[model samples]
Target chain A: MNASTSQDRFCEELTALLPRLRRFARGLARDPADADDLCQQTVERALKSRQSWQDGTRLDAWVYRIMRNQWIDEVRARTRRSQTFTHEEEGANIGAPGDLAAENLVELGNVGRALARLPEEQREAVILVLVEGFAYKEAAEIIGVPQGTLTSRLGRGREALLRELGEIA
Target chain B: MTVSDDEFTAYVDGELTGAEAQRVAAAIAGDPALASRLEAQQRLRALLRGHLDPVAVEPVPESLTQMIAAAAAEDAERDMTDTKQHEPARVLDFAAARARRDDQVRAARPPRLTLPRWWGTGAAIAASLVLGLFFGMRVADDGASVTSGGALVASGMLAKGLDEKLASANEPGKLRILTSFRREDGNYCRVYDAGASSGIACKDAQGWILQRTVANGAPERGAYRQAGSAAGELMAAAQTMAIGEPLDAAQERAARREKWNK
Candidate 1:
């Protein structure tokens, strides 16, 4: 097939996966706008390195890897600028609590805030496994951790999340 | 026998297999404490999903779909360019080299000019032809466009501005054309940044149709992208609207002379 045909097919496949991509993005960035921006950047990066994406590998995992990297870079840049020194400060940057309250969606708003308060790695692990429902192996590969490491991070992340929600000991 | 945290975590994830999984399941059923721990893990997973999963189903913003489409267009252009550069070499070495070798063995016989297999497939020729058409629509330049009342209609100066303005040299005027191109529908489209607002316009039978406009606000010298100040955003919309690349100066001039092919 010609390049155009190949690219069109590739894009069609990728576009079908956008909703899941947005969900993962929302998990990473509490703010809706930021999540969309992150999704945009991920698509751009994946398209640029189209050849580097091996066929037969899961495209969702590849795109997730790109998004995770992009989010990490953004966080580091924000930190260097001292824009958000703590995770709570990061949640503040999202500025959704007031809006959530206005809409009477306080439970969701609190859950989102609590998720954001987890350390970055823990949050990533938890989001991939819990929110996105990637299998353990696939989640490990996307997060670039060994199976054991992924499970450990997930354990810590879930523990923290439950504690923050005041659900259990 | 008590399970370690790793085992418990793995069990929660369903990683344990065969007898081990069975063992964990039986243990949980027998021990209230173990069952409660398992329940907490499952609840936490469900709660997280309950909170954020709504974003998955919510209508994806138009900007995101546009962005993804724009990126795909770009990747196609890059791939076409790469193929154009390398395809000929492979053809010459494989087909031409074999033909030359055959001619040498036949002494004084004329060499058969055999085109590459892909040449017969018509992909290379089709690829080149499509490149110009694709890149014309794919490459991003500058400006943005939005509809005023959900439709892209324009008249008076906006149409006149597109017909006369040269993107290369900005005129100190209200409406400046950042770039122009032909849409796939054979209509002409222009992206314009008009001081406080930027938008895209396409020429139809009626005249320039305003596709989209962003209220960029007062052009601040230094600040976060004020509303839709990013001309690239407008250009992206133009690309989606366009059939091919923004016309070069020569093409633009010819287009103007023809009054945008109207």
Candidate 2:
């Protein structure tokens, strides 16, 4: 395909990946608005640098990596400005009322708060492997870590989440 | 021998293969503690997935889609520039060349009001009333209709344009209809943008009541940013008002034909 056609096709495919990317971002960022912003930044960056993306590799992985790096950059920038990344009030307001019962909603809220409490590294690993369904190797590649590191993070993350959800003592 | 936490995690994740996975399974079968731990891990994973997977299927926000479209348009423009650099030029008559240049300039410029015939009486009265009530005598030239009290208010052509036009018509400089949806109260609301400003208006007896308008700095004439900070209020308004998924093109067409009746 010609350059423009290829880019158009790439964007079309990228659009299909948006929800998954946004979910991953939600795991990484503390608030829904921030996560959406991160997702938008990743998409914009990915489109601007489409020439650099290889044609055959997993586009989802590539986009995930972009989101990961974007989040890191945002955190660094926020740190330099001495601003807090997690907005407790904003994060609290982020949850929309769903079709679930009040008890299930509370449970979901607990799970969300628990997920948000995990260390950033552990959260990243859990989201990639457990949520996004990435293999250890694929998740590691997206997070720029070794397979062993990813596995360890997932293990620790699982334990923490289990404890928080009262699934374990 | 006990299976390590990493091994258990790997097995649960379906990453273990052959003898490794078999060995873990056998260990779990033999050791009750290991079995319980494995069960806990599995449960936790499942529970997290259950709680979070909904986000993945949540309706993709319109602002994000607009952002992606804007980026793609920028990419296309860059591609056009690159192609122009490599292509051969064609000679044309002076008038034709000038006309082509004018068209290009016009395309680059933001949408301007063409003053449709109905504007003379209808829009003129609405515009004067809204402007006088909101901005008093001296209106701001920021392309945003706002009140003297520093609130965004839609009036005149902007309000009328959003009411009468279908997004499919694709008029330049006109209010671009971003999306439409019915509110919980059964009123129809639309997200719209002019050259620079964007807001949400819900139809009522008063005619396209301006629910909320945002006056961020004007984006470049033809270049709209979907996720601009200016849209934050409008987005929040849309999120709060939208009862369900915004209507698709066909639904939007039908709604327009019905003159946005409930």
Candidate 3:
């Protein structure tokens, strides 16, 4: 394919990857707005660095790596401040109408709260392996960690998550 | 022998293989405690997935899809630089000629530098100027719009064009104004035919926030009247966002006189 066509194909494929990428971002950011911002920034960087991405390799992994780095390097600190500025005050305003809706809210709340309690490292490890369904090694490479480190992080994260779920249940 | 927590976690993730996996399997089968731990591990994964996966099903924000469209439009334009539209091998050869013609050719070409039309409010100009001064990447002269305080704000000449130009004026600049109308929420929105892309920006509290920009399949250079698929899409978007027919020359001129105030 020509360069432009190839790039167009890349963008097309990248567009297809958005929904899953947003889910992974939500796992990392724990805030919906910040997660969306993270997704947009990731797509932007992915386009800018399109030449760098290997064609046959996994686009999801490559984009996830960009997002993980973008989060760690830049977005995390900035969004954390804004999340408090807007979302925290705005959070209590979310109204659940009935018992079932309230129950569902608490269930989601339990998951988010549980994920929040873990350190960022452990949180990502758990999200990558368990929630997003990456293998130990693939998740490791995406997060720029060794396989052993990822396994240990996942183990500890798994333990913590289990305890949190048990307490809430 | 007891499997370590890592081994157990890996087992739950099904990451283990061959004899190592067999050993973990054997251990879990023999050890009641290990079996329960494995079940708990499996349960945690299921729980997290149940609550979190729904986010994937939620509708994606239009901003994101638009950002992708904008990026695609950007690539289409950068790839455009010329009119003949060659095949792959020739496109590269053409790249060499393009490189000879202008220093900024190919992907290395910088973000937008000229204004076909608009300038920001003085404060908007000052904010982006200071922003450009420090950030370096968010340059002013090249781009018609730049992000300010996390929001998209029309910058430089484009902002000036948006504030003053009327569609009914009938003269075309490098960037042609497609239409100007009030949106459903009463914001004054203007569409511009920007070569490879068609963009619409609405005047807002932060200046003109580029509401939508979609890439036309190819840049016709000066063919403003011809509606390509991208133009069709951009017009459809404008149609959806607009409250009524686009303003006439008199209306546009008057809106300009009032400084586009709602």
Candidate 4:
């Protein structure tokens, strides 16, 4: 069919996937506002270039991939523009031992902080395999890595998270 | 028998086949250390899933559905606009309409594309058409019309300015057009364009609203060759434009509620 018609169809499909896409963005972004902004950006990009979308292909993966790329770009931009600062130095400290027992909320907060600290590759593997429930192969394809690579990243990510959360043996 | 990390991970993922899987299971059953490791892995997996799975399987949001429908309508308008500008004599094709609908669904979920490999070829053809239209329209006098020389000249500085300027305030060598309109929610949404780059910017009561930037040469190349390969990138950008469902007459009225500050 003609280009315009195809693009029209693409917009329809992309609109349908927004909620899931927003959720994925939220997971990656952590902050609701950032996630929503990212989701909006993802949708905007997908709609504008709907013609680039392959017919009969999964729009979720395509959108996720775009979100992933956008997230990475943001992180890179943040890193480039900002000065290096530790969590504590940045006013993100979770506090010490005496404060720990009373801090279930803080502990959960720590989980998010630790998750954020994991390497981007590892975090992606964890998000895809553990959160998204994608099969190993599917996760690998989405991340553009080998299945073995994804498995390894997931393993390392989990191990690191466990250590950070004080759950590791 | 003892299971290594790989064995345990595989077992947890249910990847081991036949005797090997059985072997891992038996090891986990009999060996405390192995079983403990398995438990730990399982717990970690569970926690991760607990946090993330909900996001994947969550009920699709209504806003998203509205956005998708509105996007579809917007694409139809864009198509109509293009057709009017480029091929006014031709009648709209019904098969093309159905195909466009199907294409929308397909483009919405790109991961599903791999399962049916045969559909890929058709997707590629459709993708080429989409990109061709986008680029063709970029060059053509309709739908965000851009003169070739004007676009090329605008590319160098505008692209950089949009990339750098986050706020609506004017910066050196930056062209910002701002318009305020009430959104469906009665909140204002703004739109802007960075003149140097072929990027559109919108803003509302909130600061810089939305910025959609496209590098000029890429569209030019795709337009001339009608290359299907470039369709993926083109489709991605198109989706970005799908942000606020195309401004409806009512929404446009709402949008006019606030004056845009460029």
Q: Pick the candidate with the highest DockQ.
A: 3
Clashes of each: 19, 1, 10, 55
User: If both were scored by DockQ, which would come out higher, candidate 2 or candidate 3?
Assistant: 3
Tell me the chain A TM-score of model 1. 0.79
Across B7-75, the per-residue lDDT of candidate 1 in tens digits comes to: 777888777899998888888898999998888888877878888888888987787678669877676
Off by over 4 Å in 2: A1-5, A83-108, B70-262
**lDDT at A144, model 3:** 93
Question: Could you give candidate 4's per-residue lDDT for residues A1-169 as a string of tens digits?
Answer: 4676567667766765665776678667766667777887777777666667897787778878888888888876665444344354553343321122343335436556666667778888888777666778877887788898999998898889888765532
State the C-alpha lDDT per candidate. Answer: 0.68, 0.67, 0.68, 0.56
TM-score of 3: 0.53
Candidate 3 lDDT over residue span B1-262, tens digit each: 8898767766778888999999999999999999877777777878888868999999988877887888788777656432233435476765565454334211222243221111112112222222222223211233233222345677887788788776655355555576777898898998765544557889987888887775443323332222233344455567677775566554677788888878
Q: Which residue pairs clash within candidate 2?
A: B111-B173
lDDT of 2 by residue, A6-77 (tens): 778788789888888888887787567778889888988887787888887899999999999989888767
Evaluate residue B75 in candidate 3 and report its C-alpha lDDT on the 0 to 100 scale.
73
* Candidate numbers, best TM-score first, in rank order: 1, 3, 2, 4
- Model 3 reaches an interface RMSD of 1.7
Q: Rank the candidates by lDDT, best first.
A: 1, 3, 2, 4
TM-score of chain B of each: 0.42, 0.39, 0.40, 0.28
Local error of candidate 4 at B216, Å? 50
Query: How much of the real interface does each model capture, measured as fnat?
Result: 0.68, 0.65, 0.65, 0.46
Better of 2 and 4 by TM-score: 2
